[model samples]
Target chain A: MSIRARIDALFPRLASEQQFPTQGQTIFVDLERQEVRRAWIPHRVVTQLLGGRGVNMFLLHNLLDEALEPIHPEVPLIFGTGILTSMVPSASRGNVTSWSPESRVLMDSNAGDYFPSFMKLNGIDHLVLYGKAPKWTLLHFEGDQPKFVDAAPFMGLDNIDLRAKIANDFSGVEGKDYGLAAITTAGENLVLCSGIMAGPKAIYARGGPGAKMGALNLKAVLIQGRSADLSTARPHKLRNRDVAVKLLNTSVVKNALKKRGTPFLYKPSRMLGAMGTKNNQETTWTDKLDAENIDPYRPGMEGCFACPVNCRPLNDMSVLGESGVGSRESETPAVDHVAATPDTRQPTPIPDKYVKGDGPEYVTLGKFGPNVGITEVTQVLRLNNICNDLGLDTASTGSAISWAMELYQRGMITREQTQIDLEWGNYETIERLLFMTAKREGFGDVIADSSQAVATGKYPRESLDYLMAVKGLTQSDPHDARILKAFALGLAVATRGMDHLRNRVTLEINAKINDSPDFKAELYGGPVSAEPNSYEGKETAVRRCENIYAVGDSVGMCRFTTKLFNSPSLPGYEEFADQVANVTGIELTNEAIDHIGLNVMGVERLINAKLGITRADDTLPKRWFEEAIGVGPYKGEKIDRGEFDKMLSRFYAISNLTEEGVPKPEWREELEGVLTA
Target chain B: MLQTESRVTVRLPEPLREGRGDVITMNATSLGDIIAELDLADDRDELFNFAVNGDLVLHGEKDVALKYGDEVEIVVAFAGG
Candidate 1:
C-alpha cells in the first residue's frame, strides 16, 4: 500500500475519543451564576472546524446575538487552542473571540506564549464565558475541577502587579505549575483600546477583547497543571527538535531574528521607503530610530513556548535609565534578569530606574516611533514598556496620538481640549496620554475609544478624514501600504479591520523572488503579482495569503514559522498537512487543509455578514487614495481609485464572495455543512 | 569612457558599512557592477535590492545603465510586520 493509503488505513475508523488531542473538554464559565462546568467538545466540531480561531468562529456564529451590544451579558467570549497548539514547534498560540467593543464587529484576537499550552495541559482545549459577573471574578482551573474566586483584590492592578499578586496569593510556580491570562487597569476601566496580557509579554491586543473581558468583570483566568505527563497525557508526540532544525535550516531570516529579534525589520522597512512617519504624512524618517540604534537598550531575547525563533527582544530599563512602569513601588526594578550578569563581566549597577520587558516589537516600534514622529529609540522603548504594563494596545494608542497630532497641526483642536500641546514627536505628551488613556482620564478617554470614535460631532469632517482606520480598528504596522498593492488590498478586506497580520504579503517586497515569473504564476496566479506597484494580480495574491494566514491562525502556528509573512522557505500547506497527520494520526491532504482555511474564512464572513458588512466596508482609508507618500523613494505612490475598485472586485470573485463582499450562497451552504457536521 | 568617468554615490546600511564606511564614492557602470565591487559575504542577487536616485529598482531593472552622480542605495532584502 502507498504511504497515504497506509496512514488512512491506520485511522480508518477515527474513533470519537481520538478526535480531541487535548482533554477534549470545553469549560463553560457562567459569570452571572458564578458557576463553572465542563462539556465534551463534539468530534464533529474538532474534525470540521479544527480548533483555535476556527472553532472560535463557529462558537461566535452560534452564540452571538446580533441585536445586543458587543458587551452585553448575552454575548459570549470564547477561547480556543489550535488542534496542534502544544504538539508542534512554534505552535503556542490561542484565540479569544467576541463581538468587538471597538469595531462593533466579530473580533478574534490571538497571542502566543505558555498560557495556551498550559490551558491544554490542564485539561482545557476550549473555554466559553457566558454572562457578566456580579462582581470582579477569577476563574481558576486546577486539575479537573474549575472554580471561581473573588477577584476583588486583583482589581485595578496592572498586569505586572496582577501576576506578582497572583503568585503571592495563589498556590503554584508561575510557568511550571500554572499559567495566566490577565488584564490591567486598562481592561478594568473598559478602555476600548485595551488588551489582555498573555503570560508576561505577549498580548491579545486587537479588537478590544481586553475591554470585553473587563465588561464581563473577569479579572483573570488561571490554569494550574504542574506535572503533565505528556507520554500518557497527550496522544501525539512532539516533533519540536526536528521542526526547529527544519525551520532554522530552511528560513534565512530566522538567524537574523534570533540575533536582533523583530527590531531587525526597522532597517529594511526604512530602506523600502515604506516606514510611516508623522501619521503617514511622510514614508521615511531619520536613522536615529533604526534597529541598531535601539540595540543598546536591548538586554536579551525571549520566545513563545517551544518556539526556536525567540524573536521577542527584551527592553533593558537599566540601559535606557528609566524605571519601568510596574517598578514604581520599589527603588530597584522588580525584574530578575536586570540584576543578573551577562557573560563573565560583573553586572552593571542596576540603574536608578531598572526594569525588563519583552519588545517594543517592530509593529510597536513603528507605531510608537516614526508614525507618531518620535525619533528617540529610548523614548519608544519607554512608551512600549508603559503600554505593556498598562495592558494597552501600542498600535492603536500610537495611531490615536498621531491622529490628534495631525488634528493639532490642522488647527482642528486646541490646548483647551487636550490640555497638553499635541505636537508631533512630543514625547512627554505621548507618554502622558498612554497613562491617561489607561486610567480613562479627560481627553485620553475620548481618544481611548479609538481615533475613529473620537471624530463623532466633536471634531470636524476633516478630522475624520485624517483618521487612518478601516472597519473602525486603527491601522497597525506603520508601513505605507499604498506602495505594495497586495498589502493595500489586505488592509481593505481584513476581517479584523486595518490589521496587517491578517494578510500581509511580505513576498511582494522581495525583488529577487519577483524575478521568477513561474514562481509568481504558481503561487499568486500571475507574473504581475510579483510587482509591488502592479494591481493586476494583487487580488489573487491577497486571497491566497488570506487563506494561508487563516490556516496558520487556526493551527496556532505563529506567522513567523510559516511562509505567509516573511520566510518563503518555512512550512506551508504540504508541511502543515504532514504535521497534522503526525499529531492526529488522521490523513489530511494539502488541498483538504487549504479547503479548511477557506472554510474558516467563510465562517468569519458569515459572522460579519450577520453584523451587516457590505462591499463598501471593504475599502482602504480615504487618506491612502487622496494623499501620496510626500517624501522618500516611494514618493508619489498612491492607490488609484479605479484600480483599487477593480482589485476589490477581483478579490471578491477569487474569494467566492459577491460584489457586496459577502460570501456567496453556494460558499455559505458549503460552510454550513462543515459547521453543522 | 562615460561609464568609467561616472562616479556613483552609494549608501549602505549599518551591516555593510563596516570598514567601507557609511557612504562610498565608487566608479561602477551598473547596479550589478557596484554590488560586485562591494566586499559582501552573502550572495548579492538574493541578499540585497537596489534603489537609484531614490526609486526602488525592480528585478529586471538592475541592468538599467547608470549615469554620473546617480545616487544608489543598497537595501537588505527583508520583510516583517
Candidate 2:
C-alpha cells in the first residue's frame, strides 16, 4: 500500500470512537498556486500520534525530503493543535515545527491558549504551509475555505501593533476568534534569531522561524475562528469533568511554579554547580534574595487555557521609563550576574540608578551577562530588549557577541575589524553592535554568522576556544562537565546541538527535592551534594531524564510544568497512560506510551544520523579540559577528559547504543515505522 | 598598653540566621584572620576582598590596619547565570 493509504488504515484501527470526529478537516494551502486543498485525517492516526505536537512531528518527518539543513526553504512549516488543545482544561497549546536555522536540526516551539483555539475554531486540526508565496500574503482560514489576502500594510509592525491591526481587520468577518500568531520586522529581515508572537504574551521564540519566513518572503499567516464548537467545554465533557477538575485542584502543581516561574531550577542548579555564572565561572552568589518581587506571588498570575497555576507573573511597567509598556514577568539567573556590574555609561561619581525589568531568563542572561563580561542588570536588559526587537535569539546572538568581545580583548581580533572598541562591562560598544547585527551591517554581519562560522578559519581558532557552544547552538547556561557528568554527556550528544531543554539529565542527579531525599540517596548513592560533580549514578539519572523530557515534548506539554509540576513518578506509567487513554479515548499502555516517546526521539536521531552526526560532533570544547575557573567553590577544578569518555561509554551502554553512542538499526526501525506511517 | 582586636562582620545564609541574629561578629588583626576565626571552612575561600568603610580594599604590600568604629564587609563570589 502507498504511504497515505497505510496512514489512513492505521487511523480507525488505533483510535477510539469519540477521539476525533470521523470527518474532521485537514487544510493544505499551496502559496504558489494560490489554491486550497481540504481532506480528513482519520481519528486513528490522531489517537496513535496523540495529536498536536506528536502528530506534527510525525507528519513533518515523513513529508520533508530528508534531514535537510533546518533553514532550507523546502522544509514544511507545520502549525498543528493537540487532542487536548480545544477541550481539556489545561490543553491550550499549539506546536510549530520546522528545521531550525539556529540549531540546524528539527526545532519546535509550543505557544499556549491562543493558537490552538483559533486553529480549532477555524475547523483545522493541522495547517501546513508549503512552498514560498509569490508575494507577501495573509492566509485566512474561515470555515472550510482558506483565502489568500495581501498583507503589505501589516508587514512591518511589532508583535503588539500587528496583533491590534489583525484583530481590527478580522473583527466583523463571519466566524473568527481571538488570538493571532504574526511575524515582525525581524522575520521580514530574515535574521536567524527571529520569532513569531501569538496573542500578546505567548511566543514561538526559538530556532529562527522568523528568519525562515523572511527568506521565503511570506509575511504573516493569521489563524482566527469564532466557532463556539471550539470551546473548552467539548473535551471537558468527554474526559469526564472530574479528570479536568483533578488536574486543576492538584496542589503540588500550583505551589512549585508560583514563585520563580521556570528559574526555580536556580537553587537546585546552583547546588549542582550547573548554574551559569560569570560566563560559566566557578562561583555562586551568596546573599539574601530580594523577597519583594518573587514572580509567582506578584499580581495578575496568568496561565494557559485550563491550568490552575498561573505561573507567568504580570509586571506593571508603568513605573519603568515613559514607554508605559507593562511586561509579563519572568526571571533568569543572568539578572544577578548583570546587576553586579558597574554601569560604564555613567559620568564620574556614577549614579547607582539603573533600568530594571522582569527577567534575563537563563539563556539570554547567561550569554549577555557573564558570557560577555558585563554583570550590570540594566546593561543585560538593554541587550535583551535589543535582541528581542531585532528578532534575534538571545542565546546565540549574545554568545556570538561575547565571543567576539573576548577575542578582541585577548588580541585575537583587530580593533579595526571589530569596529567597536571591545571591553568587558562596556555597554556603549555592545549596544552599537546589537543594532549593527540586526541590520547585518559591517562588523555586525560577521557577528551574525555565529561562533561556528567564525571558528572556520575566518578568525583565529584560538578565539573559538573560549566559545562554549556545540553543533552551532550555544550552551544555554554554563555547566561544568566535571560536576554534572551526566548532563555534560547529554549536552555532548543531544541531536539539536548543545541545548539544556532538549535533554535535562541534570535533574536526575538532583532529584531529591522532586521526590523524598532518602529515596533519591538510596537510588543514586550517598547523598550527593547539590553540586553536579559526583559521578555516581549520573548516567542513570540522565537517561531517565531524557526519556521523560522526550515524552513531554511529544505529548505537546511544556517541559517546565510536565517535569516540575506533574512529575512522571506522580501517577506511575499506567496512570499516565490511562490519562492519555481517557482524554483521547485510545486504550494505551505504559509500554505503548514509552514507545511513542522513544519513537519521537528516535526519528530525530535518524535525521541527525543521516546527516552523518557522530561522536566527533558530540565532543565539548577543548577549553573545558584545559582552563580552570579563576576563583570560587571550584576554582582549581577542570573537567577530566578521561572521566567524560567513561561517562559517555556508560551512557551508551544504558541507552542500548553502540560504543560510539549511536542507536542501533533495530531502534531506528521501530521509531521510523511510527513516524513515517 | 591597652590591647584591642580588629573586628569583621559576616552575613549568614538563612539557615544560619538564628545563630547570628543579624550579622555575626568576629575578631582578628586582618580581614583574612577574622574569616579564619569564624571557623567557616566551607566559605573561607569565597572572600575575595573586603569593603572597609564602604571603599574597596586595594592590593598593597603592607596589610591595612583596622580602627575602632570602622565598618568592614567581606564579599564572597556566589553562583548565578
Cα lDDT, all candidates: 0.75, 0.54
- lDDT string for model 1 (A494-587, tens) is 9988888888877777666676668666776555555678897888778878888888888888877776566566777776677766665556
Question: Over the stretch A351-407, how does candidate 2's per-residue lDDT look in tens digits?
Answer: 222222334344565566556665444455556555544556676677677677667
Docking outcome class, model 1: acceptable
CAPRI quality of model 2: incorrect
Per-prediction TM-score of chain B?
Answer: 0.78, 0.50
Best by TM-score: 1
The per-prediction tally of clashing pairs is 0, 28
What TM-score does prediction 1 earn? 0.89
